[model samples]
Target: MVKSPVPVFLFITAEAVALLANSAFLVVFPWLVLSHTGDAGKTSLMTALVTIPTAVATLLGGRVIDRIGRKPSSVLAGLGCAVAAAGFGVVSGLGALNIGTLIALGMLAQAFLPPSTTARDALMDAIASVGGISLERLAGIRQVVFSLTYAIGPALAGLLLTAISPIAAFWIIAGAWTFAALLTTGLPSGTSRKVSEAAITPSGSVWKLLRSRRAVWMAVVIGFGASVITQPITSVLLPAHFRDLHQPQLYGVSVSAFGVGAILGALLYAAVGAKAGVKLYVGGVLVTTAGIVAFALLPSFWILALGLALGGLGSGLLAPMLLVAVTRNTADNERGQALGVYNAASLGASPIGLGLLSLLLQRHPDLHAGAFAVLGVWALAAVYALTRPSVIVSTPGQQQAADTAAV
Candidate 1:
């Protein structure tokens, strides 16, 4: 049941575009805001306005994705991005860019994105079923694609910002997503599986899953634990530390190294499937913990890059394994909701983890290195929970069976 190349291409291209749209915001919006407002706080506020809405709206978006079907949701999301990009571009071109307008449009564009992501994943799951693709493999591929896009997107944004006006970056972003919409428009929309049935009723059953008491706990643990590392890698800890070491501009290079490592790790994990997944999960956590500790201790730019790369590898392994577990456990009808929940949990944990770490750093400068020590402990705890008897651990045979079924 090999999947047709066309569907695979469409799926991957769609994901790339969707990701580029999201990633480009981090680039385009700040530049747009800066160009207009000329204030860093205004730029930060614009970012918050966009991201907060998306995070809060994920569950609702999931329901929408389920109702409308994945393809349509994807198109709508892509179009939303395209339109937002175009609007920002036009406003910038007109010299009428305003903080109020950026905040409003940013939030609106992001509102459509999370549902689109859940739908895209739901669609991918359905396609995998037809193509006989392994969920593990698909998950791994998705991680690789995400990392690659993250690596490339910022550079492209930088180039657009430099070559054109900062506002022009929005146009480039819009153009990139327009291409993504074109690729995604071709996705097969056959009603193969419905994912809404997995939604937990408001009768407190949602808490059962949220409490990390079921098969879904695997996702919760990874989501939360991954947040601890992701924040440090993306912001204050890693980037600032690099700059302190005189390689401030190499921020992208260091992050790209990690992304590249993540791609490699995902590829390796996919090749091995579930047989290696548990071991990889445990090992990756250990590697990441070690990497964090190393980065804190060494503080050299090269050493920090190496440690971050290792940490990224660990993160890459943890995420897809968690995704496979969540997808496999949920019924098809509820799959979209289940994934949406997992994604929400994972994303929601970031602010909490980073906030706590920030507070700790502010209070106890001596605990600079020790902050990451807590993350290491969190990673270890996550791995331990993953090995618990209730986790419905996958075997190689089960992996192959699911893989075969996917096609």
Candidate 2:
């Protein structure tokens, strides 16, 4: 009912909050469950349960965004996430929580998050169309925000965990999600000037799109492989290795180094991406792969820091590039769905990859560095996938199809 700024900053704030709520609690919640249950399996399940529903909900969320508009779907998702977090807080205080209860609540919380995120992606795309900004520029802006969130959110979560109770962390996350809901309420109506009206000729349906989008599938594979490399460094290698060296504090420093590098990389992308074009994506992947290799081989803390930063920067470039690329093949009408599939694959693969990495660490501790090499291979595969004829933005038929689909 109320008017808002044309190029409003609310979406930015909403996006940052969404990232904070989704990621900050990731470090907080597992520990909360472990403190209560003292069961490793329970803790693991608590951690894994959220991803399943979130991934499933993401696909549906895309269609919902297309049908209902981005703002409304996002607001609904934000509200759901806030309410779930609030429920966890209430249950924790009342001593009514158990593993089953926590998992159920966590599932509900995550299911809402992907919908909110998909809507945000759609809204950003729509805004870029209205502003006459290129997709790369929009992606650069998104990269900056994501980088900042990854940099700040974990530190804030850790500080909250140490200074107060983990319950306080949940409250903080709830407040963030609630703020996203409020921000979404203020966004103006659609400014999409040229969404094509052609019916999505169900070319194989949603399942077909999921199957045929080689870039999307490659994105998932490469993302999962990268996560396998990174998660172990965060969870196992850093802490254990640093503890052995009697420099546990370096563990935190190393993690911070990765975050700072990501922020810097995203900033760099924001500055040069529109002009850099495909070079940005190509260079980023190579830098990232090299960084991962260096991280594994270099035992010194300083070198490790540099490697992590380089890799983070590389990771930062892909998001925006991939977003733009995904949208190129998608019709304006189906932008939400296409982006959802791309975003979902990117989000969905990490847990599976990380889980397998954890298993490898347990079974073949010597293969730890091998994990990084695997990521490099995957990145090369992703590069190859991006080069396929169907993925090239220069293809007229695909471009025409994309233009028609968005309406």
Candidate 3:
């Protein structure tokens, strides 16, 4: 119904490659720290160093993206990642790698990620507008692409580490980011010129814009809850559960099933989510809570896998739906900032969730199920509180009109 969609596809391809590289680095970096230093504390410290800077950068990077334009910002961010990755590879190859170097490289690599993500989202919005596609549909496709990349990234990192070395893995990550940078160069320079212009004017205060949009703030709150519930489950509880069961294989299977279900969920959303309403979003939250409860309580391995898959499917739907809500509620000039804040809220929740879960586990060492049950209930309450009818009410016609006006 619109013009060529080649640029949109290319943008997604580039973003997918970048995400894969980052995911692989996430796998390899901690492994390198553990293998080299043999200290869990050092690994945790290095992770914290990276994470804190990344969160701060994400909170601030929207202004940079809005000022410089999406294409150039994305290209520069990709190049920055490539440089950091290559630097780490060289350091490792020379046998001079240390915790300090790792921390520096991690900070450098991670600081660019938020800007890259912001640029990618802005570019996708532009492309979707040109292609006459709804933002919800485009978001679904993006989620599927991301899920596929995430599914492959860790496996690829494991293979490279087994066959080659960490240095080689770092080099591969660098190459992937380099490829992403090159792809960004092909995008039109003026894809979102109007938004950029608005961003450059004196009226583009992110705080003011955020204050005006109640829906955007609500979306951020919802995203934070989703992150708090889901992140610790995968990073902490699931592994511990599998270890207690004495079947490490179940962990891999459960994770794989989750990824597959996430892909399927995204595809289903792409097919029929455009016409879906607030009930769909509420259903996703409920399903995710139910799956978490099942995963915590169910003793059978097959049932556990099903629970993980159901949770993943529901989790997959929440992200795109929230993105749609935020984009629909905000102005084009403020979209980048809104996304940045939303992302910050989500990323910032992980550590808070992890810390709280850790404290609970310390107090009751054998109460993993109870901890998860509490998280599930917390998730249910958070979603219900944030996604009320007053907060997210919107008809398809209103959304379509907003999209058309944005273009």
Best by TM-score: 3
Question: Better model by lDDT, 2 or 3?
Answer: 3
Candidate 2 total steric clashes = 10
lDDT of 2 at 201: 24
Report the C-alpha lDDT of model 1 over 206-324, residue by residue, as the tens digit.
44544433556556666667775576557766666656667778887777767877888888777775567456766766776766666666566788789878877877776777777
Q: After superposition, how far is residue 94 of candidate 1 from its true place, in Å?
A: 6.2
Q: How accurate is candidate 3 locally (lDDT)?
A: 0.77
Number of clashing residue pairs, candidate 3: 0
Q: Which stretches of candidate 3 lie above 4 Å from their native place?
A: 92-96, 192-208, 368-373, 376-407
What's the residue-level lDDT of 275 in candidate 1? Answer: 69
Each candidate: what lDDT? 0.69, 0.70, 0.77
Error of 3 at 1 (Å): 10
Winning candidate number (lDDT): 3
In angstroms, give how far residue 387 of model 1 lies from its true place: 4.2
Q: What clash pairs does model 2 have? A: 195-407, 196-407, 331-405, 331-406, 332-405, 332-406, 332-407, 333-405, 333-406, 333-407
Error of 1 at 116 (Å): 1.6
Name the lDDT of candidate 2: 0.70
lDDT of 2 by residue, 159-273 (tens): 8888878777788888988988887787666632223335432433765664565554445455555554566567766687678679988888888877777777777776776
lDDT of 3 by residue, 1-407 (tens): 34767777777889889999989999988887888889999887887778777787887777676777778878888999899999987887788898788888888989887788877876777777766677778989999988999889888889888987787788999999999989889866656443545455243466665555666666777778778866677777778888888988888888888888788778877777777666667667777776777777745888878888888888787778777777777655666677888888888888888888888787788755555655665666555644564455475356446445644
